[model samples]
Target: MITGGSSGIGLSVAHDVARRGASVTLVARNVSRLEKAQQEVELTMSKLSMDGKVQFFSSDISGSVKNISEMVKNAEASLGPVYMLINCAGFARAQKFEDLSPDLMKQMLDINFTGPMVLTQEVVRGMKVQQEGGVVVFVSSQAGLLGLYGFSAYSASKAAIVRAAEALHMELKPHNISVTVCYPPDTDTPGFVEENQTKPIETKLISEAAGLFKPEEVAKKLVDDSLCGAWSSTVGLEGFMLTTLCAGMGPITDAASFMAQVFLSGLFRSVSAFYLWSFTRIVEREHKKRLENKKSE
Candidate 1:
């Protein structure tokens, strides 16, 4: 089962997984997008399986109890056993500390952390009872590990995922269930590009400084890493360092902590600048190539 499987990294992961003879059950919010994604998956999986059956279930993740439960049941019925769960349905919202609101924070948490956690519980029940046990993957971000200029809510939500994944991994170990948490650097998704156009000046500058990742490449590596069930899989250098620094956020505070925050923030800004510049250029080139292709067609 793959949540957020309608677009971006989730779709890519779904496409890859269905090829390895895994019957993919895709979950997302938009019915049309899910249909399109399922088609793409079916088209790709055809080369690998002559009888692969893929299913799609659409639901918004903002706490839909009955609908979500039904979707899972239907999906399990359509496919076979639910042995693996890849949680990729998530997004980052850019907001300064000043603009942050309680509602917005909850919104971020509900989708990025709470939804995945709930879905994991549901799947774990099935896997546990069936005695087949399973693996769980959460598509977290480097934002969770490191603080960015204007990602307070986003980072907090993602950070929660890391902690949640770790705890869940430990608990599920007794049931032979492996939980894999992933952190990918800035990737060349339409979401990233759209964000760059309107994010804070500081965020834009910081993001520009940090290097960017390709969605396809990141997607491939992320799914592979998840299947391998490593403790943690960070896709880039910046993400790795941030993960290390975030380890001691609770213990560090006061004047010394303030200084450390300043230093770390500066370091983050510096590193992100290079990433932003390189990735923005890549997107620009790709955008132009796409325009040319459309004109020719």
Candidate 2:
């Protein structure tokens, strides 16, 4: 089951996973978009010559927990037990911290953090009942790893998921269930386009350094990592470095990654300081430019 499966990374993952012969149930708020996504996934499955059922459920994930639980129950009734739950339905509203409204902050928290947590709770209960462990994937952002200009609310919401995933990993490990949280850099998606409209110049400049990724590329890496039971899935070198540097209290089951984290954490921290300094300079320069323009006017 994939939330936010109607578009962006979620839809892309639906295609990839369906092609690999896994039935998928896409959950989203827009009925029309979900229908289109279901058609797309089915078409792709046919092209790949893989027989997998593709279904969709339209529900506002930020709604009541009972509603979300019912949605999952219906999905399981149709598709059998959910072996994987992907929490991908989220959005970002980037703006200066001072300019953000309390409502916007609450909405961001509800959609990005609470929605996923609620859905995960429902799915995990089912997994426990069946006594068949499953994989849970959270599509967190690079903003979650590091705070940036114009992303105060977004970063806070996403950062919560990373910590929550860590706690879930430890608690569910005994049940044979594993959790994977992906830290994807900015990707080319409808959400990214919308986010860019509100992004400050400094935020854009700082974010561009990480480069943009395609939804398909991000989805492939995310699905593969989740299937492999990786604790964290990072898109590129920058993301990998951030994950290693921010390896706070998560479960690091891979010996190679653990050794690398131990050896390179300090080095990465030094490099990250330089990056942060550059970002700070950009913010200062942009502010100065704006002030100068205001004075000239």
Candidate 3:
């Protein structure tokens, strides 16, 4: 079962899963979108093979844990117990600290991290009961590994998943259920575009320097990693750069990781300064304009 399976990485995973000859159960909001996605997945699967089925439950899995349980039960009844679970249902939003509220932060956590973890719990319980163990993948982000400015909420949510997956991977090993947390760089998806909207100028400047990924490339690596029963994976070369960046360079390699960190942070600081300086200039100009208007009056 794939959550947020209607689009982006989730949708891409759906196609990959079906092509691998697994019947898919897609969970997401928007009935029409799911239906459309289901059709596309099936069509692609058919081109790849003669036998594959696609199904979907069109409701918000982010609403509650109970809904997730019920939906999984319904899906099991139709698909004969899911053999895999991909926690890909997440969204991104960004804004300055002054503009975002507590509720919005919670919503970010609930959907991006909480929703996936809670929903996974429901699915894994079934796998445990049946003892028919399978694979589970958490689609985390590089942002989860390193703190990026303007991503306090998003980063926290992702960091939680990375830690959770590492812990769970150890716990679930005895059950023969493989757990993998995958981190990918910015992919060319609507979600990425949406996130760019609220991206702080600092983050945006860094993002502009990033190498954009096509969703298919990310999906391919993910499917391969899941099949290989990996405990953790970084989905691309860009991801590897992030891994190195996070690992921190040492004296043997003479790697200036501290410098790297500073370099990255400087990019953001510069943009932040730009915005602040611009705002200051605008206000000063406005004040001058007002004083001149008063003199004219």
Candidate 4:
């Protein structure tokens, strides 16, 4: 079961899962898009000649727990027990701290962090009862690892997911349930496009350093890492460096990752300092330019 499965990374994950011969239940708020995504997944199933069923439930992830629980119950009834629960339904709105509204902050917390956290609670209850352990994935962001300019609210929400997933990884380890949190870089998605519109110049410059990725690429890595029971899922060289550098007290899913984090910590710190310096320069330059324009006015 994938939330936000109607479009973007969520939809891409649905296609990948469908091709793997797994029955899928897509959850999203847009009924029309959900219908289209269902058709797309069914098409993938047909091409693979898989007998897996495809269904969709249109609902908001930020809605009440009662409604979310019902959504899960109905999904399982249609597609059997959920072996994997991927929380991919989230959005971002980049704005400077002073420009943000109280409502926007609450919305960010509700949709990005609380919604997935609540849904995970419902799904894990059944997962623990079933003999087959489950995989729970949270799709966080690169900004979650390091705060970025113009992403005050957005970064805070995504960062919360990372911390929660870390605790969950420990608790669910004994239950044979692996929780993976994926920190995807700027991906080419509808949400990313919308987010860019509100981004400050400094934020754009700093974020561009990480480079953009495709939804399919991010989805593939996310699904692969979750299935492998890897605690941290990330893409690109920058992503590897960030995850490794910020992997303090995180679950050591593999010996290799642990070794890399241990050995490369110093080198990554040196690199991060350079990156931080450049980001500060960008912010100062932008501020100066705005001030000059105001003087001219």
Off by over 4 Å in 2: none
Q: In every candidate, how many clashes are there? A: 12, 0, 0, 0
* Cα RMSDs, all models: 9.6, 0.8, 6.8, 0.8
Give the TM-score of each candidate: 0.80, 0.98, 0.81, 0.99
RMSD of 2: 0.8
- Clash list (residue pairs), candidate 4: none
lDDT of each: 0.76, 0.93, 0.77, 0.93
Candidate 4 error regions (>4 Å): none
- Candidate 2 per-residue C-alpha lDDT over 178-276 given as tens digits, one digit per residue, 9 for 90 to 100: 999999899999989998998888999999999999999999999999999999897888998999999977798788779889999999999999999
The 10-residue segment of model 2 with minimum total lDDT is 248-257
Q: What tens-digit string does per-residue lDDT give for candidate 1 at 38-72? A: 88999988876546678888787657766677777
User: 192 in model 3: Cα distance from truth in Å?
Assistant: 1.3
Q: Which residue ranges in model 1 land beyond 4 Å of their true spot?
A: 244-297
Candidate 3 lDDT: 0.77
Per-residue lDDT, model 1, residue 116, is 86
lDDT string, candidate 4, 1-297, tens digits: 999999999999999988898999999999999999999999999988999999999989899999999998988887778899999999998888999999999999999999999999999999998656999999999899988888889889999999999899999999999999999999999989988898888999999998999999999999999999999898999999999999999999999999999999999999999999999999999999999999999
Query: Per-residue lDDT for 112 in model 1?
Result: 92
